[model samples]
Target: MEVIAIQKSTLEGMKNELKELLELTENATQKYAPIFKEEKWLDNQEVCLMMNITKRTLQTYKDKGLLPYSRLNRKNYYKLSDVQALLKAGQPYKSNEDGVIDQ
Candidate 1:
């Protein structure tokens, strides 16, 4: 094997550059942390519990195009925003005075 050597100054410069890049990446992540937090995804059970419905009912919603979802690996996921929008719209179901969904 042949041996290759890098100058001490060059090695130091590379280290400094790598450190700066790490710092920049960290700052960017922190700055946009809240935005990522807002876009939460919920699974089938969670959505059903939140909406006070059953799996079949949730499937009906998907069938009727009232709710949107994403399917991955034979499992489904729903966006918190879309669910909130559906609740606000009160199309297929309505909530009574006690906040119970009325079908």
Candidate 2:
């Protein structure tokens, strides 16, 4: 392991930097927590597991506009509330005996 020394002058600067970093983190947490706390977004695997469906079936739902999602960085995210609403509303996607909807 390598050890580094900070002078007294640098110590105060480092403390100030740390404080600013923490403040920025706090501000971000305060701003973003509530926006996302209520509704969590699920990825493809999560959605499939939650709905007891396969990835292809999930894709079929997306294709048919039965499921809603937002794409970010080429990844799809589905809102928890939307998924719950779909389950509560009824079968969002039709499935055969194998539990996979025929596309």
What TM-score do all the candidates reach, one by one?
A: 0.54, 0.64
> What is the per-residue lDDT of model 2 for residues 1-103, given as tens digits with 9 covering 90 to 100?
9999889999999899999999999999999889678889999999888887778788887888988999879999999988888778876566677875653
Residue 48 C-alpha lDDT in model 1: 84
Candidate 1, residues 1-103, lDDT tens digits: the string is 9998999999999999999999999999999888658899899999988887767778778988999998869999899999999978875864455656557
The prediction achieving the highest TM-score against the true structure is 2
Worst 10 residues of 2 by lDDT: 94-103
Prediction-by-prediction clash tally = 0, 0
Tell me the spans in candidate 1 whose CA falls farther than 4 Å from its real position: 1-38, 91-103
